[model samples]
Target: MIERFIELGQGYGDLYEMLEIMKTNQERIHNTFVFVSEKDGKKVASFAVAMKPVGDSKFMPIYICREGIPYNAEKTSQRYDLFKEGIEAANKILITLEVKHSSAYVETTLYYQYLIGLLRLYHYIPNLG
Candidate 1:
C-alpha cells in the first residue's frame, strides 16, 4: 500500500479542517495521532489522521497539522483539547508518539519517508504489496 502524509499546517487554525475531515470520513479513519517533537527546545505536536486506503487506490492519506500544540501529556491547549474531544467522540484513542524532527533530514521527502517507515514498523499501515 502507498501511504502519504498530507500536511495541513502548524495547528494555528487549520486544525478545524483536519478535524472535520476526520468527522466526515469517520468510517474510513483508522488512527488519529499526535507526533511530539522538540524543535529549538520547544515541545510541539503534529496531529495526524490516518485513513484506510480507498477502494483499490492503494493511496492511504495521513493528514496532518504539523508541529503546533505542546505535547499532550505535558500541557493542554484549546486546539489540542478539540482534537482530543474529536477522537473521543469518534470512540477512538489518539496515539501519541515521540519522534525525531524533520530538521534532522536534509530533504522534506526524507522526513515523510521516515515517518512512513515508522508507521509500517508499528503496523499502523500495511506493507508494500
Candidate 2:
C-alpha cells in the first residue's frame, strides 16, 4: 500500500478540518496516533489518522496536525481533549509514541520515512512486500 502523511499545520483552524475528515470517513478509519517529541526543549505532539485504502486503490492517506499543541499555553488543552474524545467516540485504538524531532533529519521526507518504518515494525501498518 502507498501511505503518505498530509500535514494540516499546528492544529488550530486546520484541526477542525482534520476532525471533519475523520468524522466523515469514520468507516475508513484505520488508526489514530499521537506522536510526542521535544521541540526546542518543549514537549509537543502531532496528531494523525490513517485511513484505509478505498476499493482497489493503494493510497492510504494519513492526515496530521504537526507538533505544536499545548496542554495550557498559547493553545489550550481543549484541542487535545477534542481529539482524544473524537478517537474514543470512534472506538479506535489510540497509539502514542515518543519520537525524535524532525530536525534530526535533513528533510521532512526522511522524518516521515522513519515514522513509517516504526509503524510497520510495530505492526501498526502492513509490512512492505
Candidate 3:
C-alpha cells in the first residue's frame, strides 16, 4: 500500500478546505487528526484528514495543512474549532499526536517517512504491505 501525505499548505485559509474535504468525502473518511509540534520554539499544529484507500489501488491519501497555527490551550482557534466540530458532526474523534517538527529532517519526504513509521507503530495506519 502506498500511503502518502498531501500537504495543503499551512493552517490558515487553507484550513477551511480541509474541513470541506472531510464533509464532502464523509464516506471515504477514515480519520481526522491534529498533529501538534514546535517549530523553532513556536507551538504550531497541522490538521490532517485520512481517507480510505482507493479500490484496488492500495493508495491512501492523508491530507494535511502542515504546522502553522499557534497552539494554545488557553485560547480557542476558529480553524481548530471548525475541524473539531466537523469531526464530531461526522461522528468521529480527531486523533492527536505530538510530533517532531518537519524542519528537523533534511528533507520533507524523510519527515513524512518518520511520521509514517510512528503511525504504524501506534497502529494509526496499517503496516505497509
Candidate 4:
C-alpha cells in the first residue's frame, strides 16, 4: 500500500478539521497519535490519525496537523481538550510519542519519512504494499 501523510495545516481551524475527520470516520480509525517535540526550545505537538485503507485499495492515508499546538503537562489548550474528549468518546487509545522536531531534518519530506519508518518498525501499520 502507498502509505502517506496528508498534511492538514497548522492552526485552530486546521485542528477543528482534524477532529471532524476523526468523528466522521470513526470506524476507519486504525490509530491516533500525538507527536510531541521541542521547537526553538518550546514544546509543540502534532496530531495524526491513520485510517484503514479503503476497501481493497492501494492508498493508506495518515492525516496530520503538523506541529501546530502548544504542549504542556501543567496545562492544556481548549483545542487539545476538544480532541481528547472526542478520542475518549470514540473508545480509542491515543498514542503520544516524543519525537525530533521536523526542523531538524533538511526538508519536511525527510522528517515525515523518518516518522513513517518508526511507525512501520513498531507495526502500527503494515509493511509497504
Candidate 5:
C-alpha cells in the first residue's frame, strides 16, 4: 500500500478545506490526527484526516494542514478549536501525538516518511504488504 501525506498548506484558512474533505468523505475516513510539535520554542499542531485506500490502487491519502496553529494545555487557538469541534461533530476521536518538527529533516518527503512509519507502528495505518 502507498500511504502518503498530502499537505494542504499550513493550518490557517486551509483548515476549513481539510474539515470539509472529512465531512464529505466520512465513509472513507479511517482516522483523524493532530500532530503536535515544538518549533522555535513554540508548540504547534498539524491536523490530518486519514482516508482508507481506495479500490485496487491502494493509494491511501492522508490530508494534512502542516504545523501552524499554537497548541498547549494552558490555552488553544481558535483554529485548533474549530478542528476539535469538527472532530466531535463527526463523532471521531482525535489522536494526538507529539513529534519532531518537519524542519528536522532535510526534505519534506523524509519528514512524511517518518510520520508514516510512526503511524504504522501504532497501527493507525496498515503496514507494508
Candidate 6:
C-alpha cells in the first residue's frame, strides 16, 4: 500500500477545504491527526485526515494543513477550534501527536516520510507493502 500526504496549504483559508474533504469522504476516512511541534519557540500544529486506500489503486491520501496554527493550552486559535468542531461533526476522533518540526528536515518530503513512519509505528496507518 502507498500512503502519501497531500498538502492543501497552511491552516488558513485552506483549512475549510480540508474539513470539507473529510466530510465528503467520511466513509473512506480512516483517521484524523493533529501533529504539534515547536517552531521558532512557538507551538504550532498540522491537521490531517487519512483516507483508506482506494480500490485496486492502493493509494491512501492523507490530506493535511501543515503547521500554521498557533498552539496554546489556555486558548485555541479559531482555525484549530474549527478543525475540532469539524471532527466532532463528522463523528471522528482527533488524535494529536507531538513531533519534530518540519524545519528539522532538509526537505518537506523528508518531513512527510518521517510522519508516515511514525503513523505506521503507531498503527494509525498501514505499514509498507
- Give the alpha-carbon lDDT of every model: 0.86, 0.85, 0.85, 0.88, 0.89, 0.91
RMSD per prediction, one decimal? 1.3, 2.6, 1.2, 1.1, 1.1, 1.0
Which numbered prediction scores highest in TM-score against the true structure? 6
lDDT of 2 by residue, 22-95 (tens): 88889999999988888768888889999999998988888889887853334648778788788888888789
Q: Which residue pairs collide, candidate 1?
A: none
Candidate 2 achieves a global lDDT of 0.85
- Candidate 4, 97: how far from true, in Å? 0.5
Tens-digit lDDT track of model 6 for 6-125: 999994679999988878878888999999999888999899999997788889999998998888868988998899998998898999999999999999999999999999999999
Judge candidate 6 at residue 112 and give its lDDT: 98
- Overall local distance difference test of candidate 3: 0.85
The estimated TM-scores of all candidates read 0.93, 0.92, 0.93, 0.94, 0.94, 0.95
Q: What lDDT, from 0 to 1, does candidate 1 have?
A: 0.86
In candidate 5, what are the lDDT values of residues 2-99, reduced to their tens digit? Answer: 99899998846699999898888878888999999998899889999899877778899999999877788678888888888888878888999999
After TM-score superposition, the amount by which residue 33's alpha carbon in candidate 3 deviates from its true location, in angstroms, is 1.2
List model 1 lDDT by residue over 1-129, tens digit each: 878889988856689999898888888898988888888888888899999988888889999987767764756888889999989878888888899988889987899899889888998778888
lDDT of 3 by residue, 1-129 (tens): 788999989746688888888888888888888889997777888888888986787999999999877877579688888889989978888898999999899999999998888888998888878
By summed lDDT, the worst window of 10 consecutive residues in model 4 runs over 77-86
For candidate 6, list the clashing residue pairs, or say none: none
Model 3 lDDT-worst window of ten: 10-19
What is candidate 2's TM-score against the reference?
0.92
Clashing pairs in 3: none
Winner on lDDT (4 vs 5) = 5
Query: Cα deviation in Å at residue 120, candidate 5?
Result: 0.3
Pairs in steric clash, model 4: 1-129
What is the clash count for each candidate, in the order shown? 0, 0, 0, 1, 0, 0
Worst 10 residues of 1 by lDDT: 66-75
Instruction: Between candidates 2 and 5, name the one with more favorable TM-score.
Output: 5
